[model samples]
Target: MAHLLHIDSSPRGDRSHSRRLTREFVEAWQQTHPADTVTYRDVGRQPVPHVDEPWIVAAYAPPEQRTPELWEAIRVSDQLIDELIAADILVIGLPMYNFSVPSTFKAYLDQIVRVGRTFAIDPEDAEDPYKPLLLGKKMFVITARGSSGFGPGERYGHMNHQDPYLRVAFGFIGITDITFVHVENDEHSSESLAASIAAAQAQVAQLVAA
Candidate 1:
């Protein structure tokens, strides 16, 4: 049975479209794969610590040479990485903020994407020095946005930084097989919001079944 890591980064409660969609996706997944297990992390409510000088020093230090204080500084990072390494699938609820990801979610990404853990650097190969350590995993991102037309070649595509940023960041660690489902038009009329939600729900259902 596959293990799933469910992460929600929306600060909103029941009103959050991303949060609601992610929960629905997980519930649908459970129904289909009864033996699968899930681990949940709510970084929006309980934010992960941003990287400091100590964290940076500890992250790059040699394991044997690291002192207790150094280890303590990276304790949360270690835990977050462990959780990511243990999961076979990841489902994240991402809400767009200023055309990008929320600060809390960015902090979470910084914590897990580490050297000698999620990725490796090879000095011998100048052409390709970076090697991804995490493999054979699938990821689904449910994004909520205030407006629409963020898809490739769309009207607001050039202004859309959220999807591209997520692709690059997750792809850096070998999560190349990523799918995104978006719920847009949050600031629009009720009819527009309802239509977006309906489309997103349908997409979620299809994805879960697949």
Candidate 2:
């Protein structure tokens, strides 16, 4: 049975489309894989601490060479990394804020992407210095945008950084099998919002079954 990590970054409770879709995806996944386990983390409600100066020092320092104070500084990062490494499947709920992911989610990302833990750096090897430790993982992102037409070759495609940023960050840690289900037109008409929600629900159903 696979271990799934469900993370919601939307600040809005009932009004968030990404939040609703992620819940639906997890519920459907549970129905199909009843024996699988899930771990839920709501970064919007309970945000993780951003990395500070001490955190930076602790992260780069070798574990064997770290002092008690240094270890304490990076305790949370270690725990977050451990949880990420344990999960085989990840379901993330993200709403576009200022054309990108929420700051709370970005803080969580900074905490988990640690050196010598999630990734490794080998300056000696010129060909590939940065190595990804997390592999064979799958990610499903439920994204909500205020406007529509952000797909490839669209007018606002170049302006859209939400999905692309997620892809780059997650791909940096070796998670290339990522799928996005977008619920757009939130700032538009009610009918459009409903249609987008319906389409997202259909996509979630198909993905869970697959």
User: What do the candidate models score in CA lDDT, each in turn?
Assistant: 0.96, 0.93
* Sliding window of 10 residues with minimal summed lDDT for model 1: 168-177
RMSD (Cα, Å) of candidate 1? 0.6
Candidate 2 lDDT by residue in tens digits, 1-210: 999999999989998888989999999999999999999999988999999999998999988999999999999888888889999999999999888899999999999877798889999999989988899999999999999988879989888889999999989888999999999999999999999999999999999988
Candidate 1 structure, TM-score to reference: 0.99
Q: Which number leads on TM-score?
A: 1
Clash numbers, per candidate = 0, 0
Task: For candidate 1, write residues 32-122 as lDDT tens digits.
Answer: 9999999999999999999999999999998998999999999999999999999999999999999999999999999999999999999
What are the clashing pairs of model 1? none
| Number of clashing residue pairs, candidate 1 | 0
